[model samples]
Target: MNIIHSAVKRVVKKSLIVALGCAAMLSTTAHASEKVYRLKLAETWGPNFPIFGDATKNMAAMAEKMSNGRLKIRIDSANKHKAPLGIFDMVKSGQYDMGHSGSYYWKGKVPNTLYFTSMPFGMTPAEQYAWFYHGGGMDLMEQVYAPHNLLSFPGGNSDIQMGGWFQKEINTVDDLKGLKMRIPGFAGEILAEVGAKPTNIAPGELYTSLERNTIDALEWVGPSLDLRMGFHKIAPYYYTGWHEPGSELQFLVNKRTFERLPEDLQEILRVAMRTAAYDMYTQATHASGKNWSTIQETYPDIKVKDFPPAVLKALRDANDRLLAQHAEKDEQAKAIQQSQADYLKQVRSWTNISHRAYLNSQAQ
Candidate 1:
């Protein structure tokens, strides 16, 4: 009996030591793993530049919250960085750990980057979101940006943008000839193809240029943002959107910075970005609706118009030709273009049945 009791005591002693040691190891691990990661993000917007700037702030807030303050993102707006359109180069070169900008803005550096943003008469926000999350868009984006050691995610949606504020009526295709307009990206290429002189103008200069007749027309974002820009005050014509049906802004990350993060932190950042992007869409839609109501009530004389069918056909043709040229140049561009076209066909069918049908009935 004495020998058995002694053996039990020894066993208890060993178990206690093992438990204590495990506890100490766990405490040390918890301490060591709590290291904070701080990152700097550059944005292609002025300080507090409404929707665009709000997205960056929203993403940073979400990342910090999700990681319990372990991951903090510092955002530098164009006002601070003095480079509104330099977000891609800044993030790629590690001058900034991340960026908030539109994908098509990098077309000069990487031609295929244009498709990731919205195309003229392309998918709406819902359809595009489906494409990005499910229809193999994320994988295709990986292929495009991997070479640059960068990553791109949909940062936000500006919603369907206004086609432009035209000073005079565009009744026919001939109206576009020599018509100077401020339209950028692949859409600008389309405008040029349609015989319009498409130019890129900085946001700060857009109002003054339009006021001075430096531009006959300019396509900015929709009513949500345009209201504050006072475009309606100067221009009487508020045309419907065809150029940027759903412009998806982008969140770019330095590949090295992304990979070095802890697996959990990486996920935190990813979720934060995605959530913020979707949130921006909702915000934009809401703001557009509210602001449009105000614009109509305040400026009842504003002419809301659509491009003539002939003009649309010309623009559409120009867009198709451009895409064909793009596809012929690169196999990857061909694949991306095909993917978008195929996805749009599939999703638009449902959209017609759901949103279009419902809205039409309500209008009736």
Candidate 2:
């Protein structure tokens, strides 16, 4: 009897220990399963910025779907949470986890930021993407953002943009003198040197400002957005050629927040952005062609003109001077410019053979 009782006691103790161990393991698993991360994203543009807004929203949707609802993102548009231009700083400070805006908008903080946007007479969407993805542009861009506590990804490209809208015909560079125009980044600086006063206005206020005669000219995106905003109704004269060759938008993430994500999640974000970038370019290009067709069909009263040779020459000269001045003051600007120039030279070689040949054939 004594032996049997001792055996029984040992069995009970072992059972208890086993049960406790199982309970601890289950608790840890449950805690991990319950953990969820929420990312807050902000953007300066409104919902109407065409591919910019559409691609951003699509990214959030894709993230949630890909994570199977494990990760969530909350996006705030301009003035929804923070001011438009405040997005870069907000994300950098970790006040926000993510931001979407044109890199050129932040050129004030980092002059080199303009290189990631569009340069005067710069490469088109295909050429720019080649430079960025395969030509060391991404690595160089990362270096530029490192000091700002941010990580950036290519968001979207605006393809080729229109010159601008003018209240009065700009037959010569002399017409630009004293013209108050809404432009931004290096383009704005170039305009200033040529005697046009550049102003940065939010999208929503653009129409009112132009209608009220507060601005003499404005350059938004292309005809699609400009037509939607009634820019043609107010500023009847539209000019095209080399003002903003191709504008690229960027998705910026807080460096700390980005580092905190799991490796798998990080990869998901990257893949999602890359997909978004491609989709944006495709959609913008298609929409631009359709919109141009519509403008010819519908807005027959509107006059479309190209920048005269003399005006283009003056603008190009001014842009060169502005770039040199900024590069002298900022080392990063010099580095990025050099990288872009080198990348363009290589891409242009192939593009001249392939893309240019194709375009020329079509024209013929």
Candidate 3:
């Protein structure tokens, strides 16, 4: 009985030691795995653009929170770290760890980037998001940015926007000729094709330029933001339907910076961006609706009208021609355009049945 008791004691002692060793190893690993990275994030807009600016802040906050404070992002607004349009290049060249801005602004460098932002009569915000998330649009965009040593994710989305606020009524295509307008990307190109001189102005200068007659017209954003900027006071003719269709904001990261992140941190960034994308669209839609009502109530003199059918047709035709021209000049543009067309075809098939049915019911 004594010999049996001694053998059992030895086995019990060995088991306890093994368990204690495992605990010690686990504690050591937990201490060793703690990681911290301070990321510099840049934005091309002021704090006044809450949906855009605030969403970026929220993204940073989410990353910190999800990573348990291991990752910190410091955001610098335009002119603080770099110029507004210089964001993509700044991130690509590793001058900035990350950047938040409209993808269309970089069309000169990568024509395909414009599709990720807006196109003449392109998809609405929800549809565009669907394309990006499920329709393989995100993968395609990553491919386009791969060569630039950057990776971009959808940060926010401004739902369908308003057309420009014109100083004088644009009743015909002829009136657009020689009109100096503040616009960007494909819309700017289309404006040029129609003989209007398109100018790219920073957000800060938009109101002053319009008030001082530096620009005959300007398309800044939807009604909410436009109202805040007081564009209606300068140009009272508010047109319907944005030339941009759905303007999507992008968050760009240096490829090397992204690759250096832990797998969990990478996921935190992507999921946070996806969440921000939805939140931004929701906020913009709500704000736009409220602001639209306010505009009608307070600014009785402001005229809201739809673009003439002829003008719309002319613009659409011009867009097609410009897209074709771009495809011929840029191989990357051709690939992106083809990918978008194919994905859009599939999404439209589903949308025609689901989205169309809902819209038709609304009309009823």
Q: Highest lDDT among the candidates is held by which one?
A: 1
Off by over 4 Å in 1: 1-24
Per-residue lDDT tens digits of candidate 2, residues 130-174?
A: 888888889988998999899988998878888888999988889
Q: Write down the TM-score for model 2.
A: 0.91
Clashing pairs in 1: none
Error of 1 at 197 (Å): 1.4
When superposed on Cα atoms, how far off is each prediction in RMSD?
Answer: 2.5, 2.6, 3.0
Which 10 residues in a row give candidate 1 its minimum summed lDDT? 198-207
Residue 46, model 1: Cα distance from true site in angstroms: 1.0
Report the C-alpha lDDT of model 1 over 1-364, residue by residue, as the tens digit. 9999999999999999999999999999998688899999998888889988889899999999989999999999888899888888999899999999889888989998988989998999889999999999999998899999999999999899998898988899999999999988899999889789988876778999999999999988998899999887788888999988889999999999999999999999999999999999999999999999998899898899999899899999999999999999999999999999999999999999999999999999
lDDT of 3: 0.86
On a 0 to 100 scale, what is the lDDT of residue 22 in model 1?
Answer: 100
TM-score per candidate: 0.93, 0.91, 0.91
Candidate with top TM-score is 1
User: How many angstroms is residue 348 displaced in model 1 relative to the true structure, after the best TM-score fit?
Assistant: 1.5
